[model samples]
Target: MVCLRCVMVVKEELNKLGYHYISVVLGEAEVIEDISAGQHEQLRTALLKSGLELMDDKKSILIQKIKNVIIELVHHSEDPLTVNFSEYLSQQLHYDYTYLANLFSEVQGTTIEKFLIAHKIERVKELLVYNELNLTEIAYRMHYSSVAHLSAQFKKVTGLTPSHFKQLKDKRRSMLDEM
Candidate 1:
């Protein structure tokens, strides 16, 4: 689960199966009761029906948690981090940065940094489409060091400078849900 609606679907499915959950966060839930195999299967089926899957493997769960954390920070959170993303992720996940970086690259076929840049650029695209924030403000909100850096990255990823991209007036920004 990566969004509030996803959490709601999971919670509703658990309730439907007569299971009690203490809390449901991005990629995890705290259950208040043990569920039978049949109930577990039912819950899994219900989640699958809603386009979610039950993560049973430890590594997969950890990876999901990592992705959720990144997604939340990049696309959802408004408060900027005081530290760099790598350090923040290391502390949040309680793993060495190198280990997490290697695992992410090995499993996702791209570095975590690249994933972050892609998401950030996507967010910039959304902001540009909204036309609510100027380029400098968008760069600051997205934690870029400067507008030039943001423009360079936006151009690198999308093959168009931010100003040029914004001028098109016909470009559609892809949502995180579709990514």
Candidate 2:
């Protein structure tokens, strides 16, 4: 789950299955009772239908947690991270950076840095579409070293300059869930 609506869906599904959950966050749900294999399968099926998945394995859960953190950091955070990405992830997840990187690469088939960059680019797209801030402000807000760096990365990802993209009628911005 990446949004409040997704959390609501999870809650509704749990209630439909006659289960009480303590809470449902971005990537986790805390149920009041133990889940049987049957219930687990039902949940997996329900979430799959909603374009989400029930993570069973520890590694998968961890991977989802990592994704949730990145999503929150890129899309929702007001303050940029004080530390580097790897260090922040390490501190938050309580794992060494190397292990996290290797595990993420193995499971997601992409480096953590690449994943973060993708999310950052997506955020840039969102901010550009909103037109709330200029490129310099966006660079500062998103923690880009310079507007030129941000522009280069944005162009590399979207194949168009930010100014050109904003000028177009049919701007393409990806949904967070799609990413």
Top TM-score hit:
1
How well does candidate 2 score on lDDT at residue 83?
91
* lDDT score, candidate 2: 0.88
> What lDDT tens digits, residue by residue, belong to model 2 across residues 9-35?
999888998999888999999999998
Clashing pairs in 2: none
Model 1 / residue 163 / CA error / Å: 0.8
Worst 10 residues of 2 by lDDT: 169-178
Quote the positional error of residue 44 for candidate 1 in Å: 1.3
Candidate 1: what lDDT?
Answer: 0.87
Question: What do the candidate models score in CA lDDT, each in turn?
Answer: 0.87, 0.88
70: Cα error in model 2, Å: 0.7
lDDT of 1 by residue, 109-129 (tens): 999999899889988999988
